[model samples]
Target: MTTSFPMNAGDGLYSYSKNSHLQKEIIDGAKEMMRDVIIRKLDIKTILSSSNTLHITELGCSVGPNTFSSMQHIVEALKDKYLYQDQVIDSTKSTIPEFQIFFNDQVTNDFNTLFRSLPVDRFYYASGVPGSFHGRLFPSRSIHFAHCSTAIHWLSKIPKELLDKNSPAWNKGLIDYAGASNVEIVNAYVAQFERDMEMFFNARAEEIVPGGMMVLVTPISGYIRLLRFFGSSLMDMVNEGKLDEFLVDSFNLPLYLPSPQDMTKVVEKNGLFSIERMELINIKSNLVDEVDAKTLMMSLRSAIEGVIINHFGSKIAEEACARTILKSKEISEWMKVNYEKASILFVALKRK
Candidate 1:
C-alpha cells in the first residue's frame, strides 16, 4: 500500500521548516481574508456559549513558523471580534475566549522542530496531534475552528489500480495524473480524491461544533502543471538509463488538485456544512515569476523529498532533484505563460 509520508523534517538546509517560504507567502496573503471571514461570518457568541475556551485545529500543519503564524492570525481575529462586540454591547458581558490550538499532521512530521520554533510570547496553549485528518482526529463537537492551506490536495494514498498490471489505469512512465493522456489514469485519481474528501468532510463535521468555521486553501488543477515538469525530469533520468523505467511506472504522487466544482460536489454530498465562500485567490510569488532553478528545486524538494525518498531511496531522490534543477529553463518558460493564471481555491465553510 502507498503510504503518505510527512514533509521533509528538521531544521536543516533542505528541511521544510527552512524551505517553505512559498507556502509562507500563500499563508501571509490569506491572513487578511481569513481575519475578515472570522469577524463577519464566525458566530463568536454561539461558539463562546458552550465554553470559555475555543479549540482551533490546523490540519496538515507541517513544521512551523507558517502554522504558528496562521494560528496567531486566528487568535488575534477572535480577540478583535470580542473586543468589537464589547464596544457595541454591554462591556460587562464581554469575554474573550481562551485559545487551545492543535497542530495536526501525519505521524512522521517534525513536531520537535515545530515546537522549538514556536514564538515564546504566544498567547495560546499549543499541542501536537499526529494522525491523518482524512479520519477522525478529535472528539465529537470539540473543534471550534479548523484551517488547512495548500495541504488538502494530498490524497490519503495512491490509487491501487494505477499499480495493478491488469488494470487499465496502470500509469506507466508517469508520476501523476496531471497532463496524462489516459482518461483511465485521470479517473483513478479523481475517484480517490472524491473518496478521501468525503471521509474528510464526514470526520470534520463530527468534530467541529455547530457554529464552528473551516477555511481550506488548496491549489486547484492549474498548480498540477508544475508536477508535470517534475515528472519530465524523472523521465529524462529514465532515458539516460540512470534510473529504471519500471520504477517510474510504479511511482506516482499521491496528490490530487481538485477544481472548485469538484470541491462543491463532495461537500454537498456530505450535507453538513454551509459553503460560506468559495473563490480563487491568486498567491503572488517571485519564484513563479522568475523561476530560479536552484530555488525552485529546494522548494519542491522540501515539500516532496520525503515522499520520493520513501519510494525511490535517498540517492536516487537527490539525483532526480538535481536533474529537475537542470531543466529550469524549460520550467521557467512554462511558468511565464501559465503561472499568471494559476490561483488557489479558498473555501470557507460553517458547520450547520
Candidate 2:
C-alpha cells in the first residue's frame, strides 16, 4: 500500500517545527479547546473510571516542541479531572491514571529526532506511531481523545482528477485548482476535499470510543482563498513572461481549507460524531506595519520545501526554478500592500 503524502518531517526544517513561536495563537487555541471540551462535553469521569489507562493521540504531530506543550496541557487536564473525581489529594500517593500518548505522522517523519528531544519531565508514556491520519492507525474504540492542529487542511494526496489529462479538471498551466474560472476544476478540488474529510472522520470514528472527543484546528476558507489568490498571482507572473510557466505547472500543493459549515456536514454525514463547538478566528500578523518577506519565505519554505523537492527534483526546485524565489519576493511585496490575515477554525466534536 502506498502511504505517501506530501509531508514536512525533516527534524527542524518543517514550518510546523519552526512556526511554534509565530503560530502560538493556534497552538494555545488547541490547548484551550481541549480543556474546554473535556470539561464541558466529554465524560471525563467515565473515561477515567472505565479504564486504568487513558489514551490520547495527536494526529499530524510534526516534529515539534509545541506538540509536547499541547500534549502536556492535555495530560495535565486529564490528571486534574481524575483527581477531582477522586475527591482526594495525596501529595505522596498517585491518584491519577497513567497516560499513553501516541504521536502520529507520516512514515517519512523524523520520529528519531522527535523522540530523542522529548522532555525528560514528560508525564505520559510517549510512543511514535508513523501513519497518515486519513486512514485508521489504531484499534477500534481504543482512543479517548484525538487532537490535531494545523494539519487536516492537507489532503492525503493530490486529487487524481487534477491529473487526468482528458478531464475538464486537468489543471494544465495552472499549478492549483484554486482561482480556476472553470467550475469543473473547482468542483474537482471540492470533491477531493470532501472525500479526504470523510475518510479522516470515518477512520477516527472507529478508533475513538463512544463519547470520546476530537478537537480539530484547521485553516478556514478565507485562508484558502488567500492562498489561491497568491497561487493565481504566481501563475500570472509566469504568464507575464517574468517567470517560467513550466515551474508553475510542475508544482501544486495538496491542501484545502474548508468552511466551518462544510466541516460540520462531514461530521454529520459520518454519523459517528456530533459537534460540540466550532468557531473561526482571524489571526493577524504582528508585523502589521511591514511585510517581513524574509520571514514569510522561511515560513513557506519550511512547510513545503520537502514537497517542492519531492515533486521537482531538488536541483530544479532550487537552482533551475530560481523564479520561485522571485515569486516569494513578489508575494511578500503584495503582502505589504494588502492586509494578510489567516482565518482558522476550531472544531470540537464528540463521538457517538
Candidate 3:
C-alpha cells in the first residue's frame, strides 16, 4: 500500500488550516443532524454503566480549527444528552460523563499544529493518536463514540492496477477515475473503495463498545466534478508541452466518494453496525456564493498540494495549480448550472 499523504500543514497562506472553510461549512451543516442522532440513538446508559468517561474518537482528524470545532460540538451534544435527553428515571442518575477525545490521522500528520490550535477552554481531555483509521488505532471495545467528517472518502491507497501498463485498469494521463470514459478504471477505483471501507468498518467494530455510536459525514460521488476539472487542468498543461504526460499517467489520487446506496451495502455486509439514519445533504444550501471556482481551487489545493508536490515535484505542481486558477472563469460558469449536483452524505450507525 502507498503511504498516505498529510494535508498541507502549518498556518501558511496555502495551508489546510487556512483554506479548510469548505470542510468547516460541511461540518456545520451536519451539526444538527449529528446532535439529534446522538440524543436519540446513542445508548448513554449502557456507556455510563461501564465507565464514567465517554471515549470519543475523530478519525482522519487533520491539523486544526475544523477538527476542534467538530469535537466541541460533539462534547456539548453528549452533555445535553446526559443532562436533558436521557430517559434515566432515577433522579440520582444525573451525573455527567467525563469526555476523552482522541484525534486520529496518519503518523505524518502535523500533530504539533493541531495541538497548538486546540480550543483553550475545551471540556474534554484531548489526546492525539497517529495511525490509519483503515486499521485498529485503539484497544478493542475502548471507544464509546466515533466521528469522521468529510474524510472517509479517502481510500487507504491508490489501486495498484491503475499503475500497471499491462492492466486494463491502467489509468493513463488521468489523475483520478472521476469522469473517466473507461469502465475498467472506474471499476478499479470502486473495488479499492470497497476493500478500504471493509477494513475501516472492521477496525471500528473492534474498537467501539457494543452500544456505541458512529456518525460519518462524507461527500457523494457527484463531488468529484471539482476533481475532474483539476485533472483537465493537468491535461491542458500536457497538451501545451509544459508538463510531462508520463507524470500524469503515473499519478492517481487515492480517494473515492461513495453513493448512499454504496455505503449502506458496506455497512450491512459488515453486520456490526445497524443503520440509524442516512441522507443526502445539499452542500450548496449551506454555502451559496462561496462555491466559486477560485475558492474551490484554494480548498482543493490545500487538501492535495502535498500529494502533488510529492508526485510531480514543487516546480511542476506549482505551475499546475496556477494553470487551474487561470481557468476559474470557465469553471465558475459551469458551476452556475451544475453546482447542485454536489451533496454530502450523512450517516448514523449504532454498534450492535
Worst 10 residues of 2 by lDDT: 287-296
The model with the greater lDDT, 1 or 2, is: 1
- Writing each residue's lDDT as its tens digit, candidate 3 over 133-233 gives 98889999999999999888888888889989888988887788887888999989888989988999999999999989999999877667777667888
The TM-score obtained by model 3 is: 0.95
TM-score of each: 0.95, 0.85, 0.95
Query: Where is model 1 poorest over a 10-residue stretch in terms of lDDT?
Result: 288-297
lDDT of 3 at 134: 88
At residue 126, candidate 1 shows an lDDT of: 94
Better of 1 and 2 by TM-score: 1
Number of clashing pairs per prediction, in order: 0, 1, 0
Over 1-352, each residue of candidate 2 has an lDDT whose tens digit, in order, gives 3335433555554444664443455677456666866667767667555578899999988776878888999888877776665664444555668899999988888787689789899988999898888889999889999999878878777777777768787776665655677788777777877888898899999999888889888866544433443355556666677667666665667777778878887888788888899987666655332245444544555566576677656664454234443455565656655535666788998888
